[model samples]
Target: MDKDWIAYSECVWQCRSNNESSHQTIGSSQAFSVNMASMNEPASTTASTTHQSQTEARTTSSMPNITQHSLDHNPDIFTIICCNDSFQIALDHSTIATLLRVCKRVRPLLSSKVPRFHSWWRNVGLWRPNGSLRFALTPSEQIALSLHCEYEGIADRSWLDNQADQGNATALFFLAWIHQIDLDSQQSVNKPKREAICQQIIFYLEKAAQADHPMAQYDLAGCYRNGLGVDQDPTKAVDMFRSLAECGIPQAQVALGGCYENGEGVDQDYDTAIEWYSKAADQGSEDGRLHIVFLRGWFSFIGHGVEQSDADAFNRWHEVSTNSTNPVLKPIATHMVGWMHYLGRGTVQDKPKGVNIIRENRSDEFPLGESESLAANWADINSDSPALRKFLGMCQFGSDHEWLCKHLVAVCLIHGFGTRQDQEKAAGIFEQLANEGHSVSQLWIGRCYSFGKGVSKNDEKAFEWWSKSANQGNSYGQWMVGCCYYSEYGVTRDHTEATEWFRKSAELGNRYGQNMLGDCYKNGCGVTKDIDTAVFWLRKAAEQGFENAIYKLRQLDQWL
Candidate 1:
């Protein structure tokens, strides 16, 4: 074998070993055997020397090459390498370097030949005895091998035979985990293959994590974070993230930082976000870079948690805008770039570019149809307005306006617009809005209770709140109270009293009150019936889609 290939092979071999000493010892004997055996095969075929034999040899020789071409297309490279590494570590006590070397050689071999055997080979290599690695592993190593085989999604009968040969506590634990994950006692949804795999992973992960494996700690954190085969708890997730972060894992550092920034199972602290981001950033994390930029820009702009410096803020954003290789960072950078252009802050004046960037980032979001139209309409209403803030708030609430469909859903419930006159639903929404101190919502809630439009009737509660709103000069509340007395909903029936209230509401030119008064005169409910007066008020309310007035107007003269 040439010196360079041998050296490369040796390094690869080391990755599969438990330690440096093991690599040197293992490589000394097996390195040349593999190189010589593979090299001699070509010459041996050529020496066969008969036309028929030569043709047969050529076809068989080309078989590996054909398989190699096919294996190159399988896209999941990283996952395979990781699986191989995990097996080697568990079985032979091989280090990552040795595993990498084995993978480099075996991947091409498996890729060119029968790629289907990659998982099987990995499991075997993981459990293989140190000295007799080419054949079989020790009893304990075999159990780890079996668990790993199941974890990698293998289901061949031969694979089961291999597992039974090494099955032990480790294998049993892995099986239990696989069962727990894939088999739900309450549901028959678990597929046999996935159930078996889940049982194995859970069992092993629990055992290994308890034994202080960094990978297990990281995985446990993820399990808690997502409630994967376990209860989800952000606090437990943070704890796990912290433990793993202490061990210097980049992903754990990022996760821990997220907990600190959002106050999820931790205190909200920008300083901590900055601190954790820095730690992860030092390890070349793309996410860390993006977060650093965001935190620095936000803190610098507001002069909170970090020192004030617009130049520094823009510089941080500009750095991420230019430097990061992460795909997720691209959209975030585009968003911040758009903001900079829109505000003409630190960056060159370029609204068109900013808009383009925003649109580009928007491409990743849900397809906007009528929601875009609503946004455009909303924008046209106030060009120099803070509409972006409202839109962003909606996004935060998980209701992006992707459809642009105009929905008076909230208003419809309030005024019995579409489905049904639901005062209970209306009151609930009013309460929601009123809690935000929106005067319109507060007034509507009072009216809903007072009239029992879709809710049970309440008089004292309505009157007390209405009086407060009236004192605040709420015109709608004033009109609503007047209409209540006029209709005699919760009060004693009295036409004179009703008229007095109607006149007060009418002076405010409340169209609803006008329509009500018109009803009174037309029906002689409070005053003498008068068609002319009814026509006047009905025309006013019809313009607002008031159905009552429209019906009344058709009777007047067909002038509606």
Candidate 2:
């Protein structure tokens, strides 16, 4: 055999042995293999035959004359080289060089037909037993490979720094990521160190971004958007995202859509947002699909971008309700679909189906109370359920015993359930009910003021309303009153008063109040420090599946 073929055969044999040993060491691994006629060749071949083969290889090396014919006629050989283990082994510089010398047709094919080879090498590393092949690697490639290997073992960070200093964009990006991780993990007490790391991260990220490293551009855009280690600049963030979106990056497409939708750095354009969202969805992004469904429903229902079409709204919401894998979004879409059915907006009226959907998706595990039952009955009547209306006499004017219909109407206005959303009207109704001594209405009035839903946000007003409901023995109101005192929201910070209110709420079986009361006991906030009392209340809340209480109890157990 010729020297070039001999070298190629030796390299292939070495690679095969290494692969077998690696599989054995890792315990059941699979690797592709190449079948070569050279492997079965005799130990001896005349120099004349070797020379003849070399001449033939040279004559066939001409790309236009040989490559197309080989690809057309010898498709199996091309498939074996590209799809089999030979492609992987040829990634090694020595093997590829020898292969090129033996068969020049491979050079143009590899260069033109498989542009993804370099990216695959960079991401997955070369398939050598000793890890990545180092021959012919640029400084950035070296730093990237080293950082990639750090998941398996420790890496030399100083070498990465040296590579970055040598103007390696990838090394700079990698170093920035490392420093960002360090800053995240460092304690608040290490302020100077954290600040230094943050500055270094920003510097390296900016340098790498300017060099057009995709990840660096994405990360730097985020920093600009959030004012994290950089001046907040929505325009810059939009520009970066647009650049990446043009390159067909799905995440960048999503961000660009959000920017357009919110008018952050561009005009608010729901049509543009939908267009970008559709692009991302075409790339098989679940989030993109969800965004498209939501935007379509909102635009159709509100007549914002597209023409208002109840049928379109129903179709979009139905798609999400039935097909979405996101737990949070699925329930929301289901509720919207149920609302449409209940109101007979786009589909036939189906009150039973609507009610069943709401019941199944209700977040609270507790059975519906009398008030909830009354509200459900009111909804049935509102949906024009003839049997329910007759049975409850709800069709008659002024037949709303206990003000259930009025309360349900207010809730509908507040949430836009069956009526146009009007927070002001909801708040007015709630205030009237509060004046009539309805504890739940008092609590809702407090929430409205606290969040400025319909009235000017006033912590003092919120506290006053909460106190009224608390005096009427509302557990949630009592808990809110305790929180007000604890946080000094609308009153002086008084731990004793906070604890008293928490105790009252906890006694009424409020899990949040129970957790707070336990914390107060543990920390000696209002009452004397008592570990047993703390554990008692914490266990009560934890048993009710309060996540905070469960975590606190676990911490206390560790202390014990």
Candidate 3:
């Protein structure tokens, strides 16, 4: 076999020691290359056939006349090479070299026929005993594979399309990644546009997945689960996830574990979920390890899956809050840890340390959804009256947002979280903070006057307070002001003024503002009736998990 084809052959690409912990990087004289005893001739065990086959190979190699005519005439050759089942995948270099010599002959046909590329990779890809690699890379593949730069969408679509047209599996996978999936788990396109992009993504993913691309398989399963580009099929998602999980893909393992955990397409089996999570954790996946800890915590916290143990829950939550590499759940975990510490549920009681930990999380750095902060009204407070009073005093001294910290105590008083219901006390705190020039407190006092929660129902006062906060550039206050103008709740209905306030608040990244702005655009309340603009604003808020925005986007989908 000639050196050029031999150098790029899958024998060198896939051959590795059974015990190899990593990929066998290609070299001129590595495992498969060692079969070449001389510069011109490859050493082979089948000595009788080697000389004659090499002679015939050199003759065939010189003739680049492979075309439709050749393919039509050589039907037997097509069946032998084109069929994935026919591939024996011999370990020796001579067989691979000869196969490449054949591929070289059929290069013109294979370039346009994408299916042949799929069959080629499936037949030639290695199955390591350790299951470390999905497919061993050729040097060109290694360079092409680095194109997945999340920050830079696609530097050159034509270049990648060229590679994909030439039947490059890596290129197909990247093309899929680029088309529909955004880095932040938000699609850049609105629903109508996303549907089209999702089709393109699924097309490329299927081609690459047919070639045994692991990431493509994982993504395709995600599509099935969420119905991104297709119908929701939990069975298909679970099936695909199980295949990759068995092949030691950590993300797939975690996904499979979740399927078992939640009984999505399978019977609920906590033990099985734990096993899968453990396997992923063993492979050094941070999310996998966290899942294991969380499962144990959940069991103890809920007292259903395993014997109840507050100590176990506290320890696991502590580990997640203090030591986990994944930041996704740290804020929630820290709060739980602090609450338990203060209550002396598991460890020795340390009120000061618990207070300190809770206070530390009051910073803007914590992951804040539309609601759910330490000061937010809906926090699951189980602490008693004495403990609540201590929290109230501690809240007053917190370094971040003094008014918000005090608002927590007010919410506790109103809700009777651990004290008697007292709206008067809550309204007193709101009025005092509003007088102190706190924008959020002004918004709260406005709500009190509008709803008559703790103050006399007064629309004029509500609008006045809302205006004061809006003038200070508070996003929530701005949204409230827009609402009053739009609905004539506390002011004369004025769509133009409402639109301006919504625009200002929406630009500041408030979900409520975004949803309202979309509403204005949808009905042409102030802005022009533009469905595209409405969907754009609504989708932005929906991606941030706003329920109202999500509902609006669903309503808009019927038009498309």
Best by TM-score: 2
Please write out the lDDT profile of model 3 over residues 9-55, one tens digit for every residue: 33333322311212245421132222221112322212234444553
Q: Tell me the spans in candidate 3 whose CA falls farther than 4 Å from its real position.
A: 1-141, 144-154, 180-190, 305-307, 325-332, 341-373, 377-560
Which sections of candidate 1 miss by over 4 Å? 1-213, 226-229, 305-315, 321-330, 363-560
Clash count for each candidate, listed in order shown: 33, 0, 0
Ranking the candidates on TM-score from highest down gives 2, 3, 1
Candidate 1 structure, TM-score to reference? 0.39
Tens-digit per-residue lDDT, 38-157, candidate 1: 222221111223432433343322122211322345434433543444433443322321222222333232222222333454443422343322322222223234334433534444
How far residue 291's Cα lies from its native spot in candidate 1, in Å, is 2.8
| Position 528, candidate 3: lDDT | 89
Q: Which is the winner by TM-score between candidate 2 and candidate 3?
A: 2
Q: List the residue pairs that clash in candidate 2.
A: none
Q: Candidates sorted by lDDT, descending order?
A: 3, 2, 1
How well does candidate 3 score on lDDT at residue 192?
A: 75
